[model samples]
Target: MKTISIIPVIRVLSWIVFLGLCIKAGAVLFTFTISLYNPPYAADLYQGLDLSILYSASRLDYIFLMAFAIILSSMQAFIFYFVVSIFEKLNLVRPFSEEIFLLISKISYFSLATGGIGLLAHQFADQLVKNGLVIGKAIDFWEGRDAFLFMGGVVLVIAQIFRRGIDLQVEHDLTV
Candidate 1:
């Protein structure tokens, strides 16, 4: 079997991931918006997660926490979107290109930003819980910050490798 055959499968999987993230972000945003007008909705906002205590404790904090969740989800969706783009532009014959390098770098940077934001949100939720809000479940949304950071580092290294490949391809072209 040729590796080229696998590209479509990977692209389809990336699309699935991208769509799932978008749905997650959208669901959270919709729940947050609805909860603003319908406070009772806060009792079960997006899945089994409840933020009623946080809402009852401090509206500002609740809003901020929800904002962070939405941003983190959206950023994750954006990263997968770029991955799909990379797959779309991929050419097995000439895998190294400036565009691919830039896209990979963008994914790395976005992953780093998402990880940072997730960490901040995680800490903020912990503080809120410590301050007397039952936000234990809220932390679930901000989980996996470390994983994103690690993925960012790995992708950055891959991007650098692609950069070198591009340089070598260019040198070979010049010689020919």
Candidate 2:
């Protein structure tokens, strides 16, 4: 009987995530470009469905919206990159090394950072509507964004635990 290593599973899942994020980024770029440039054609091609993120936006607004998606996707992909890093960093050697904790800690903060940006965007939307200032701004976030902020706090605590573990490991090594 042989034991199965989990590293391969981790690697496979990370690859799936990486591919998914890339597809999403590419889709945003392609769809927004086509729909913005040729609205009627894109409607016919996509069965009358468009990205919908830039609904009610003018041509200039659509351009800014695409720029926003590029920035948003870049940030979103960064989180996945951190996930891939964690998976790649985990192995038979130094599984709990400083690199892992540092990476996780970054994941924690970046997750919170994204969530915070989403929150701010929402607030800005509210202000615009309240002021009757039609800036043609349209933005939204995942339902899980608030949850991401909460999880970031939890991960920060966990990173502190790992910091202690590193210190303890150092002490233990010194004693031997």
The lDDT values for all models are 0.91, 0.65
Q: Residues 13-87, candidate 2, lDDT per residue (tens digit)? A: 888987777776776667766766676533322223343433444545445544555555556778788889888
TM-score for each candidate, following the candidate numbering = 0.95, 0.72
Candidate 2: stretches off by over 4 Å: 5-7, 33-68, 125-141
* Model 1 root mean square deviation, Cα atoms: 1.4
Cα lDDT, model 1, residue 54: 88
Relative to the true structure, candidate 2 has a C-alpha RMSD (angstroms) of: 4.2
Residue 111's lDDT within candidate 2 is 79
**Which ranges in model 1 have alpha carbons more than 4 Å from their true place?**
1-4
Q: What is the lDDT of residue 171 in candidate 1?
A: 96
